[model samples]
Target: MQTILGANGQIGEELARYLHNTVTHDIRLVGRRPSAVNKTDELFSADLTDAEATDRAVAGSEIVYLTVGLPMDSAMWEERFPVMMENTIAAVRNHDAKLVFFDNTYMYPQTAAPQVEGKTPFEPRGRKAAVRARIATRLQEEMDAGRVEAVIVRAPEFYGPGKTQGLTNTTVFNRIKKGERPLVPVSADTQRSLIWTPDASRAMGLIGNTPDAYGQTWHLPIDQDRLTYREMIAIASEVTGRKIRFSTIPLAVFTLAGLFNAPAKEASELMPRYGVDNIFDTSKFAAHFPEFETTNYRDGISQLLSP
Candidate 1:
């Protein structure tokens, strides 16, 4: 049986759909409250931070996917992420199930340099990034020690339909849909490498099912034609059949707003990434999965804006 931990999240939901449709029908969805993505899916509700609960969740599973996500609170992440990771690793080991971990690019430095799997060093700047780096390192150490079969699938920010949350989706797409002026984080001219949510999930399903793909980190496939915010807005404008205007929010404004706003304060740590080019390299995944086709910006934007 294939099980998905944190099955209610955007990534987890998409992953479950992909697995059910393409890979297996005997799927299990684990979360505090999870709705079935397919008719045959088994619903297992458990808090991953509890060891025994996690063990029960993973019992009798052949392959487990960890796609859990928490709110953007650094304190919450610092307190719970490690415990959840430990619990998951222990549970997966006890059940002798292969683990497919879904990870993000937060641990990498906030710079314009092309982020490559295994080549980029962890130079995390904020509390959240540091926490991500720690958990990821622990997983790698477990992998290197031959403790459990696992594969790490990492992706940059996400932009897609159906409750997808990100700076781009919230600030750009949602604003445009509401007929409000869009807000660009820092520099609208810097290139952004975002992965379509469905594509990322599809790639993860393929890699998790492939036996030889374990014990390595794979960057999820992304469209090669990275676009700047200005260009992205242009595409959205074209798709919506109306002129869309956007204003770039300077770093100082975000920082100032953070002083009084909890969400804004939490988001301040990630503002640096928007100021420069975010060139996430997926050449490794591309070479490995040559048959995979990524959704380009124009088509993806069109789909999101479509009625």
Candidate 2:
């Protein structure tokens, strides 16, 4: 049986649905309020932050997906994330389950274009990035220790329906919904690698099922077409039949805003990443799953307009 730790969230929900409907696998979902994924065959509510609770929640599972995290701040990571990672590691080990971590690119070296799996300049300055790097490296270390199996898959910026809050919303679709031209922090022309959630979830599932993919990190496969924020706005507007007014907010002002607010502070720090280009190569994943087809940017844009 497969179990998803953060199964109530976007990727988690997609992963659960896929496993339940396609692969004929019995599944368990554990979370802060796993009941959020209610009326299912194997969904349980539990918090991994609590050890005894997590141990009970994770029992009887062969594979577990650690797709959970917090967004409080640097201090939170220094105090909370590691504990969460440690707790999860312990839980998986206790249950003798393999782990598949749904990760992001923040841990990778800062790059202006496509990044390879084993590229250099490993220093990550973002507080959250640093924490993520530590957790990932430790997971790999544990794998080398030969007790548990693990695989990491990193994803870039994502947007679609149901992701209406948090980081992505602050920059993309939310602004458009507010009738404001979204101020993309990156260069107006900086094209970013974006994976639709379903594609990313599928990639994660594929990695979870492949033993060869264990002990390795793979970037989520995408269509690789680069489109500027302006181009994105044009496509979104075209699809929605609503002309999105365009504007650019200077990062300098954002810095000032961050001085008195946590959200703005966290948002501003990520400005550098968005202000540049993030081109990712998913050749490794593609090689294993030749049937994988990433949704095009245009098709994804249209999905955002769907009800």
Candidate 3:
């Protein structure tokens, strides 16, 4: 049996679907309140921050996935993430279950550099990033020490159908769907590397089941044809059959706006990334999983705009 911790979010939900359809039906969904994605899934409501609760959630599982996501608040992340990670690692170790960790690029440096899985060193800039770096480092240390069998799957920002939330989805796709001008952050010319949510989940499912993929970090496969905001807007326009115009939010303006807005204030640390090219390299994944196919911008945008 495979178990998913924090199964309510988009990534967890999608991963459960993929595992059910392709890998196994004996899946356990664990969260504060997780609904089964498939009829065969067993639901166990538990807070991962609690050690006993987390151990109970992983007790009977052969594989465990850690895909928890918190709010954009730094203080909340600082307070909860480490505890959750510690509990999860302990539970997985105690249960003798292989772990699959779904990670993000938050710990990566905010720059135009290509984010290769092992080559890029952690240069986390803020509290959230620092927390991410710490947990990921702790996980790696465990992996390196052969204390647990695990693999890390990292993805860039998301853009996909259904309740998927991200900067691109909120600023661009949602706005275009609402017949409003899209808001581009910083520059429209800098290229972005976004992973389709399902693709990220599918890749993680594949990696988790593959024994050879353990003890390493992987950048989830993304469409090779990265696009800038200007190009992305053009694709959306074509897909929607309407010209879409967008206003670029400069760093100064975005930073100033954060002063009075809670969400914006929480996102200010990541705002620097929107200004530069985000080149997330997935050559390792491509090389390992030669048959995996990623969704492109035009097709992804078409799906997002579709009813």
Model 2 spans with C-alpha error above 4 angstroms: 36-39, 164-168
TM-scores for every predicted model: 0.99, 0.92, 0.99
Every candidate's lDDT: 0.94, 0.76, 0.93
Instruction: Sort every candidate by TM-score, greatest first.
Output: 1, 3, 2
Q: Tens digit of lDDT per residue, candidate 3, span 167-268?
A: 999999999999999999899999999989999899999999999999999999999889999999998888888888899999998789889997888888
lDDT per residue, candidate 2, 253-292, as tens digits?
Answer: 7889889998888767667766667778878778778898
Number of the predicted model whose lDDT against the real structure is largest: 1
- State how far residue 251 of model 1 sits from its true place (Å): 0.8
Backbone clash pairs for candidate 1 read none
Which of candidates 2 and 3 is the stronger one according to lDDT?
3
Root mean square deviation (Cα) for candidate 2: 2.0
